[model samples]
Target: MNTLNSNPVHGATRLNDWGLIRASGEDAAKFLNSQLTQDFALLGLNEARLAGFCSAKGRLQATMIGWKASEQEILLALPAEVLPGLLKRLTMFVLRAKCKLSDASGEWQLWGLTGTDAEQWLGDAAPQTRWSLGQKGEATVIRLPESGAQARFLMVQAKEAADPALNPLSPSDWQWLALQSGLAWVRAATHEQFVPQMLNLELLGGVSFKKGCYPGQEVVARSQYRGTLKRRTFLYELEGQALPGQEIFHSEDPGQPAGLVADVASKDGRSLILAETKIAALASGSLHLGSIEGPLLQPRPLPYALTEPE
Candidate 1:
């Protein structure tokens, strides 16, 4: 981890790593609702959803923030590396649905705002509530839940428009804040590595248990009801860099990995990681980064409580 300077610019920045996917036509909402874990069919114009696109085996391919742009159009924000392939795959499934999926990355400029004045900077465009939407001029603003040491919000505007006046933050700095928030964003390195529950997606209101079937709906439901899931995501801090998909080792079982890194960011010479690990290992053994001889990890409390099976 690198020690960050006291400069205020670290608080906010333009987000270039994220891209957009646009779904258009009459069946946009219905198609997305069937494919993702969120209940998009009922999503109002003023609301947004955190959703996951999974594989048939229940592994997550992408985690996205989705919102309705109009009655016939929906926009999804996700990592750019996974967007192209995901859009292609989703297009293959629109056999009869009146929907079209396209990569609309070039159509929008995404910005991440954090710090005490994050809301005031957006003025009327700042969403008044979490998971809600607001409009300012041509920009669409969504207030992300309080993450890290400050408030955070995501602003999306047309590419042809002028950039907002907020101080620019480095992509790395933004990532650090996001990791500290305890919300995991799936990237290419860890694609299809874990199911929604392993990342605590359900606790974040990303999963809808009463919705109809999607790709991995059966496996997700089974894990929720049968008490069959033994692994879950947790926040940890260590003194070295921890990359996504890196193996986590336990001293008691050095021959095999105990878990994998889901998301990581460095700050003030320390690394923060969101890891999916076996619950038993968390209780009985000491966990290390990378390998058995790697740096030790200290557990940290998550921002939200985990939902236990009923």
Candidate 2:
């Protein structure tokens, strides 16, 4: 991890750039304002938003931590490897809207945080502290700092001459936090593979029931209202190594893959993993990995509760 500002950011890997793309123009807000599940219209100059970029059918493309840099400029911070395909898909919809989507990845960077040290650390070091979702920026870029007991943030390039703060925490710390958050970044292997709801986007605030129409809005809404959601994401802990995309098995069905590992973090020898699976497949007791004798997965309660269908 790249070290910047003496590693003031906790729960962050290297002080590195999270690929940020700016979609700016007269039609920008009008365009995206119509899309995305979150309310971009409510985002103030310094405020940041956590949103999902979904396919026209409503499956997730890539998740975003977006902010309004200016009235005409909005910045979306996302995974770099996933940016190219996302950009291409977003560009296809710009046929009529006067939006200009371009790669601003090299021009800016990102910083992540969690644990007790994140908030106070950034407050002490980063310039201008408009920390939460509606925080006003002082000619600088600050994504909404999560305003809770669990802390996180993404710092952007404030000016043309500005750059990322290099200080970073240990890679292990970052792994731990990502696992806790249950983030499932869209990789090539998993791209367009799982629906947003399957990744627990609804529970994570990545979906807005009150928001207007966007791609897949109907499907997302149906899943919530009808409650026929057979699959959902769950946080799991295992005694063995947790591999991303690795198949998890059940004692009842050894022939079918029950779920896939989304992300993992190692702490105290036992590893925590985020897995997407069928709700009926998981239970309180032991579940075999491959054979009925494989390591069992212990279920843990999420930080928040799932909203019941209305």
Candidate 3:
């Protein structure tokens, strides 16, 4: 097991692994609403949406935390590794929609804030609801699901803006806290491998079924209404390291793969993994990383409950 250096409980960390995509034009919101899993047409300034961009087969290509920057512009924050391809594909669909998609990573800086550091940054104006947006001068603050009791937030601001006044939090600790929050953002390695529900996106308010049609709307809808969702993302603790797209094996059925790692983060010799696996495979509670003989995985309770499809 690799031991990670410990970090302070309250501080801010610049998220270098994330990037921004800007959609600007009169049809910006309309264009995004037609392509993404969430309803963008009604996206409000004070709210943020956790949305999925999917393929025609319903596999998620990218997940985004997006909000309206203005009436005709929306900003999407996603893993930097997937930005180039995702931006290119999004632009292709804009043909004559009056929407222009471009890489905006250079225009904005992203930061991950935790615990009291986030509270101190927003002062009395902190947003209380998850996915809610608040502003501190020029910075846009979005409240994310907490990591246990510690509050977590994503702050976005212009590159020229002043940095938040807080101690520095290490990147490893910030990542660990993100994994603990049970939200998995799609990375390049795991692209097109899961439907949004497989990662509990709907439970996290990342999917909007009533929003009408999108790229994979029919497939996503069928999965939700058919009551055939046998796979789900779950949290597990392991002694060593794991990576995205790594196969997870079920002890009883080691001959074949049972799941894939959606995201993982390690700290102080232990790692937390968010994996999507068949629900039945979890019955025996025997899972392993890498191979069947690899490190044993211990199931951990997610912060939120999974709701059954009606």
Candidate 4:
């Protein structure tokens, strides 16, 4: 495992790829808790939760970081490409629930911060632990898990109130760090392609096993207790660019695809990706990116331990 020195520094980057969905109304929390994979009804202001919206068959349609902005309002942050569709789908189910969902992407500015000086940049109180939430001026800062060499946080502020001192960090750098952290951010191309466990959502606290039934809850529970999971997400590095939804083929199984790329971050000449594949194929076959004849991918250790079915 790779380790970083405990020393922290100050760095900031604009996250243009992310957007927010604001859920506000009398029944916001109750409505979301009943629809998503996280426990939103009990989400406190001091914490954030990683959550997933899955299809009826248990395939993840979206993955997001959700936090309670107020007792009646919750904010969900996710990749911008899927925000519009997801927001629409979520609204369709609101029907008579005392909740209103809307796209708040233009109203909020999202930023990524790293180093010990992060709190100083936000000029607000910041959380002390991973996945914790803090208030900074008009911004909500949520500390993200440390990835590879740096501790990180995600800050969401009203666009008009965003600080100008926060320097822009490369989006690719942010993506690489996120990939290293082993948390998959589902994008449009990969939507409805993975179950929560296949993306290691459970390990990341994205799934609440004790929470009341949500979409695909039954399938998810059965997969957990029946020990029927055969595929899981893994991290890998390759020497070229790759996109989400790209197929991976094992050398031994040339006629069949072994996996699909979940997410990818490329910098300079190399790319790092999260791929969901058969556990058995990972153990015995040589995986190639794109196709059986594509570039070979070297498997890298995930930051967290995977709980395989017994």
Which candidate number would show the highest TM-score if scored against the true structure?
3
**RMSD of every prediction:** 2.3, 5.3, 2.2, 2.5
TM-score of each: 0.94, 0.81, 0.96, 0.94
Off by over 4 Å in 3: 1-8
lDDT scores in order: 0.85, 0.64, 0.90, 0.86
Name the lDDT value of residue 36 in candidate 2.
Answer: 75
Candidate 1 TM-score, C-alpha based: 0.94
lDDT of 4 by residue, 160-244 (tens): 8846375566787777777888888888999999989999899888889888999999998888889668999999988889999
In terms of lDDT, the best-performing candidate is: 3
* Per-residue alpha-carbon lDDT of candidate 3 for residues 19-114, written as tens digits (9 for 90 to 100): 999999999999999999999999998999999999999999999999999899999999999999899889888988989888999988999999
Model 4 lDDT, full chain set: 0.86
Question: Mind giving the per-residue lDDT tens digits that candidate 1 earns over 11-34?
Answer: 457778899999999999999999
Candidate 2 deviant stretches above 4 angstroms: 1-12, 15-17, 115-117, 124-149, 158-167, 266-270, 288-295
Clashing pairs in 2: 1-14, 3-166, 3-167, 4-165, 4-166, 4-167, 5-167, 7-167, 7-168, 58-216
Per-model tally of clashing residue pairs: 2, 10, 0, 3
lDDT of 3 at 161: 86
